[model samples]
Target chain A: MTPSHSGPSDRLEASLAGFDVPAARPPDFPTADVSYAVDDTPIGRMLLACDGSGVLVASLFTPDAAAEEAALQRLAARISPRVLRRPQSLDEARRWLESYLDGGRPGAAPAWALSLATPFQIPVLTTLAARVGYGDRATYGQLASWAGRPQAARAVGTALGGNPLCVVLPCHRVVGASGSLTGYAGGLAAKRYLLELESTSL
Target chain B: MTLPPFQLLVDAHWRDVARLAHALVGPDDGDDVAQQAWLQAWAAYPSLTSATNLRGWLFTVTYRCATDAHRGRGRRPVPVEDPSLAAAERPAVDPPATASDESGVWQIVATLPPRQREAVALRYVADLDHAAIAAALGTSTAMSRRLVSDALGSLRKALS
Candidate 1:
């Protein structure tokens, strides 16, 4: 039997693309129809998904193990078949994703529409993104300090751990003060590798 | 019986979310992202009107949770279980690329810290742009870029 590539994009594109209309179906709530692609990065192949939302979910080297499970649970927790709409922009979205996978950096974003509701989280995220460097690392306590809630180190950890967006946010940059990589949502090994990369290159 | 909206949404995005959890926080952190994301989804359930696109909503919630978890907030500690190596109903694996010259990629990646691994995987494997990567790993675009860069550096050195 031919191995199924990780997703239906190729087949879907071939079959569905010919028609201007997508395999349009009434939205399935408890069961949103999902589509995704993979972005090959210098480190590994990342799984890029566009659920019914215009926003993308990128699971880095997500593998077939625990990471995949976590992504599903996260999706379950956010919205349902009752509320959000499935992707109205499949062709545009798929093309955009293909662009990124092909390493055309500008094409990483969807050309048509996206409605991400993460305004409430910009402050802490902004600081982490701006202040951290490629190889450098920060501590959870420091992140709390930056957020002006110095005592909330663990709380910050919670936020990082729950980040719906994974690599794009750089939560891995934060660590424990002991210079020990602690509590990386990805895992300690990934954390160590990040810092190691930073120290060596950036 | 119709699957609960939450279950269906959860089921569809399960693999993606689990991959995010494993790549960013470590296998240990999956529960936290999944639980808090669920809690957030449940809390915001009332606001949902269209079911056509629940995937983004779930990603946002868990992305927020992951960010919070990274910052030392909103973690739900659960019992740890050894990885079964093979789950009963996992997505079928791709046929191995026996000919790709860049072999043992995961092996080297596995050697990095969990955070770095997450960054690396999210960027390299998942192919998320900095924005989506930041959301899952709970950081920002530049920071996310750096993490991936550094991870690549480690791999480069190790492979050398």
Candidate 2:
């Protein structure tokens, strides 16, 4: 694949653009500079995994390596247990993620090339990618309509709620029907900051 | 011989349980898996004298709990109806890169079906050894290796 025209990377980038981890993200998040990327939300920390070419996985407050692994397992089930220190690939991703946390934006805006298994998730994520505008918010009902199922407002909310990529998927941008902010795995405060960043950027 | 040691073991490996459980189930459902594993571990802790594979033991409990949980629940309907995956919202454009470079690799990885992804993530990303991986996945070592090797070969072909 010469990279799908609007590959999955764009979906991830659009989703996470505004929501960096909080300023007090996590002092122990394998790095320190991102420790201050604070936001007001349920999520205490954020983890962004990029292969330099594009982001792969972005998790919020996954906690630690254990948490990271858990997230990875959820992403890829039925694991093998080989302990090789050097994996021969992914160095670029490691650097990209480091730069993302170190408060530096990537130098390039590349396309993603990961295979997504979920059928409904891609379009839902695509919608999320487009709606991300820092602090801007959209309602589940609205997203439901966008996904071609206006009656599935609740279902939309549930899907957004389960989004694993947190900031990367920009699920934080979705709110309640009554204009109230609903649940956020990374918390509401973080959501607010993401909206703020996007709002101000525009 | 005391509850404290068992408690310590549970606490020490609690995170691993959570990780494996969460991977097996969603993060929300992972709590249940962890809880069951701890109960099982506590019951088995008195005789768990050798300290070598404590992590593996705990993980196995978690993985089994998750599998049982899933089996008990029958199976989740595939194509889990969620429109928000595409319809949710996007963040404002930023300079930071959040894309990826593993379409070929993970596409094949994804093809391993879901169970294998869970095992691979637990094994490689979690740095869990074979025993731990098997324990966490609730499968035998041979099975775990087969899935992994199959996934790896798939990834290589995808990349190539």
Candidate 3:
């Protein structure tokens, strides 16, 4: 990057002209509470994050390391500050994922943390996790009723839109009121693949 | 008081922190210091009641980290000053030329005291204003200005 100034420090500028700054991220705290691991999956690179409480967040990988680090930095900034790469910490989740990929039921969802951005989202997410079974589907309107807010179909969509626990919470099983698959965090194609994977096994 | 979103805070100040760090610690360690500053900022972000100048606050953290790294380097001496090791330690951008004024200027910068070097680098390489440099150095703007003036005077005398 060119120096912004046209001052008398030409020699000083020349000394630092070619210096490249590495991408900056939030510093790790002494209390390394949040642990994350990136793994290759049938879909793509995925980040699995867990904190002292439990597994809290996951993200689809970006194209390269810098982008991925930036993405994880964002996650760490918002969710928790101490984000460390601990592959062994995610071994159980990885096993569950592998089993699910190999055409087997994931029995029950593991203990994942849910620190939603808003309180209203709790009931909506809980209702989805409880009512939407494997190979089964629910319309947004149905999920709203299950959440005890029958008139909140739109809010239900918003809640699922921000779902951090993607496949584990089965947010992909939620559909439009007309039974059409709606937008998913993992693109529609991945959504279709997940639904098909469940349907065949059922 | 509720703080502005952490993402927004980082987006606004991260580059500035990195630039200042690079000036203080050189390229490699500067990057590491910048990253450490970000992590520290994020960790303390929630407790920030009211930051009138969040960018300056972040830069202050970065400055401390860079200075700590510099102090650590002082304990373990590198052979950069030795002519025998000149070929290995020479920076690629400006090759070592004995008779050039530019080489003389670089040498002058190398010989400057630690605080003077940091103040000069912040002024020239980071292109930071007196106010921002003051915050990073944990000094008043007037003091920062004096430091820069003193550094420039030394450089000019050596060159003349």
Candidate 4:
């Protein structure tokens, strides 16, 4: 512990150095359960989560690193007990996301699997995903009607708020009955960006 | 209060875990140990109560995985038949850390008892403080400090 003339510990530190910690690699877990990766886009960082079946969740990342991590962790724990950082696992999701951003319609409707949620939410989300095409907007009430629940506009909003597949499922297209921009999980600004991105198609 | 997500935990200590794995097991086996630790941590993540101890918990998992591989080598059939396993054991081809003055220190430390080597590696290689080291080793802080001190003493003598 004494600061001598560059003693044994210092010598050891100097010599056994340059471990060249490799560029961070996606972790490969024993069984391919759940994997996640972050993609940087014009909007900001997007966190994508997936399982063996298909892409599960996509959300605008929180700026705060710790908070973002916790949010993803909670999602993974609830959705898939085993989660890891494997960007390669999300290759397809990344492709679709990039295409969508580039004003290209996703080459195909993405394969998707939803985590556990309310029964009512499933039909509402499914109808929204199918009907709300890019550059298109639907009122919450209309979405409710499409799902065969004409009086459940508010519930439809609630379901959209908890949407696991935000951009991918087109949740941002849902608006208020008056055509007013409404609440979005990615925030109202992001909603505007998406709407503009689709409308202008530049 | 909700705990920080597993992704954050992995980012924070992944490098440390990787280095510790390399120190305990050689390069090839070290990578395997770290990957296994990530899987195990994810499975056990929900059950974790104190979020503050995430580093310690992860390191503990990494340590266990490394030890398991060590034990496996002694008991199981020589994995040398597998190309990857054979590649892992080939030190001349796969030198992870470059040889230097400190390299001798590791060579010396390798000769010590397992616990002491672990103590030294966690302290020096992983750069964990005594408390974190103790937590990872599943021992009291005092014990961890003593182990590190003893290991250093031995290292100094070996160098002399």
Tell me each candidate's TM-score: 0.37, 0.37, 0.63, 0.69
Candidate 1 residue lDDT tens string, A1-202: 1235754433322221121111112223343433444444444544544565545643445555466544444444443322232334245654553443344433234421112225434545656766775556788888878877788788777777765445556687887788766676556766565556556553
Q: Which one wins on lDDT?
A: 4
TM-score of chain A of each: 0.54, 0.57, 0.76, 0.78
- Identify the candidate with maximal DockQ: 4
Q: Using DockQ as the measure, name the better of candidate 2 and candidate 4.
A: 4
DockQ of each: 0.03, 0.02, 0.17, 0.23
Tell me the whole-model lDDT of each prediction, alpha carbons only: 0.51, 0.49, 0.66, 0.70
Write the residue-wise lDDT of candidate 4 on A79-128 in tens digits. Answer: 65455667887888888888887778667756776674468888998898
Clashing pairs in 3: A26-B38, A26-B39, A27-B38, A27-B39
DockQ of candidate 4 is 0.23
Give the Å error, residue B34, model 2.
33
Writing each residue's lDDT as its tens digit, candidate 3 over A90-170 gives 777777877886789786666776653458877888788888899999989989998999998988898888776778888
By descending lDDT, how would the candidates be arranged? 4, 3, 1, 2
lDDT of 2 by residue, B1-160 (tens): 1122232354355555655555455544556666777667655654555657677666666666776776677743122122123222222222212212223232233344455655655664345666656665556777666655554554455555
Shares of reference contacts reproduced by the candidates, in order, are 0.05, 0.00, 0.14, 0.24
